[model samples]
Target: MEELWGRRVLLTKQFSAVLDAYQTFPAMIDQGAYMRCTRCNTELLKTAILLPSGFYYCPSCIQMGRIDSSLQLIHQAEPANQTREVFLDWQGTLTPAQEEISIALCHSLAQKKPHLIHAVTGAGKTEILFEAIYRALKKGGRVALASPRVDVCLELYPRLQEVFPKETIALLYGGNEQKYTYTSLVICTTHQLLHFYHAFDFLIVDEVDSFPFQGDKKLAYAVSQATKEDSCLTYLTATPPQALLKEIQASFIISQLPARFHRRPLPEPEFIWWNHWAAHSKKGTHLGKLYQLIDQLSQKNHVLLFCPSIHLMDCLFQHVQKHFPDLQVEKVHADDDQRKEKVTKMRQHHYQLFLCTTILERGVTFENVSVIILGANHPVFTKATLVQISGRVDRKGAYNFGRVCFLYDEQTVAMKLALKEIKLNNQLARKRGLVDEL
Candidate 1:
């Protein structure tokens, strides 16, 4: 029973039968006059189905394991107190700027205040959270590190496990096989947070500005519900939305890391105009320039070609493969079943180039890689996305510089804004003496 703290399960007939007769209680799960799901707070009455036996069924969150009127949700109460030894085995040290921000973050967490870390890509944001997380765990508080992207969650799991080897750390995602356990720290996707209620004392949301978490209201509600009343919330992102910026200015404590952890400036994107690229692509003509760019990068360093849509990605993939028969090329998107394998292969240097959509724009890093935006003027490419895409280049210390090319028919506001933001961050880094003397 002590191990069931912070665990929830839908009380279906199948689950009811498994419970011991003495442990079964009437008030354990209740169905009120109005049908509503206790887990997701979804009004089941709106999407209810009346059965012949005169009961209602909810289909709203059925995909997450069904919860109907006849079924009740059993949420285990959090433990009152526990004694555990917590230690961090990591030996890496932070930069002076990062150390200052990390100390400030620890102070904010101690005060239980909301804070934001507006850092550039490759700023070692994950390392900055080590001290704060150590403090939280040492105090016997549960910590949750959530990200909007599964790729980010997957990337963070092993790193955190290595750092806190003695503590119980669980990684939760869509297709994970690991069973739910009462762990001191949990790393999960934002969608998985809907299953928890007042569970975490220290909640850190990485990539807070990324998709699904940025615009969706339900995920916002899930974040709010997952944290305790006095829990400290921290948001980590390279590009924060205007609303978050306003909140940072007015209420939240904010810290900024404009330079990469390696003390290198962000790679500024180069805009190259190619007239009638869409028409040429459709007619299968005027691909000489594109080929030349790819050829240049293929000889040295991996390349990531970003397309606006799946259709465009497929078209470009076909074009690139047709033109360069000997080069190793692959295509990946959100629906690709082999996305994980493909990404792993890319990291293993099995593929020379990859044509992909915005799915690869964030949370993945490739060393010695050059980036190319095929249609920089497309409306789908936002300023924040463009910055993230450009950030894919020159992330590792071994290769501290790479080209970021924006191949466009015409420059849009998003392109200019992304470039301007990169330049401004670089300038700030220089002013603070954070950048190398390049």
Candidate 2:
């Protein structure tokens, strides 16, 4: 029953006997030729998603588990809310601006209102969430901090554990092998929300604008379904997508933080025209500007070189190795089994040049690193993505500002917008006297 608490799960053979003793509801509702998954709100055509046993299943949320016609969902009652002696254990101080936002968040939590924290990169978003989370937990409310990126969940789990040592904090993701237990605090990927039904009383979604989750209806449905009707549902992001921005303007409470916690301006990108860069990299010839930029940046700081496409990253990786035979270099992409290991090594300063695609664009941080984006004009590099990639530089405030170069054959709207947004943040910071004069 502890395992089933706060969760709605399909009645498989393992749960058949246990659930039979309890109560259950249909996992999906039938509507003639179409059946809708109650968990993810995805409608599936019966003919299109027929199981081998002639059962109709939901293909949209199959990643969580098949919610078919034959199965019922069982939900055990959540244990009574339990208070803790100490809900928060942080010793850090927030800037006045951050304190204001944190107070706003706490108000939102108390009111159970939808809210958005529109902060610049490195604006201490996680810390801003701590006080609100503390208020919720102190009152014995169930809370979940979810992110679209698995890396974010992985990074945040340990921090939450450190801050809430007395509370049971569950870390849920696709790759995590830990058994689920009913917990007061849960740090999970957004996709993991599908298993729960009206569980969390305080739901905070970080990186709400990031990939896989962005524009994903199934994942959005997961967030809504996993939350209690009267819960505080807050979104945290450096760059809010347009659709989300509209929603914020229309109804949601908003808090904007324009400066990094370190009181430094975001590093603006330098757009350099490097004609025929990819073709030259593929031919292993005529890479004067590219070689020169790498040599210059790598001398003092680690360089994260971003290629718009994985194939382009591979081609560039080979030439980089040949051109700089003496320097240590590494590359990682979404399919790379060693992605996590490589990123760990990069953070330890093991590589001079780390090449990657958009997978490394956000949710991870490295100190004393500069960023280089190849093909910044490529269709794959959206304005939000470019902003996030540039944000990877100087996150720790090791320097007053970090170098970010976009080596593109042609400048793009995304490039311009990213630069404009960064500049706007810096202006706002300066206007507020949040950053030191250069």
lDDT of each: 0.83, 0.87
Candidate 1 ranges beyond 4 A from true positions: 13-37, 42-62
Candidate 1: worst-modelled 10 consecutive residues by lDDT: 21-30
Q: Candidate 1 lDDT, tens digit per residue, 1-438?
A: 534456556544545554652122221123454555555555444324555666566555555665555655556656653655687999999999999999999998989999999999989999999999998998888999999898898789888999998877889888787877778799999988877777888999999999979976667877888888888999999999988798567667999999998887888999989888776665678899888988887777889999888886777778788898998999899889998899889988788889899998999878889998988898989999999999899887675357899989988999999999999999999999999955
- Show model 2 residue runs off by greater than 4 Å: 17-23
What TM-score should be assigned to candidate 2?
A: 0.96
Clashes of 2: 0
Residue-wise C-alpha lDDT for candidate 2, range 89-150, written one tens digit per residue: 89999999999999998998889999999999888999999888988888888999999987
Give me the displacement of residue 416 in model 1, in angstroms: 1.4
Each candidate structure's count of clashing pairs: 0, 0
Q: Among these predicted structures, which one has the highest lDDT?
A: 2
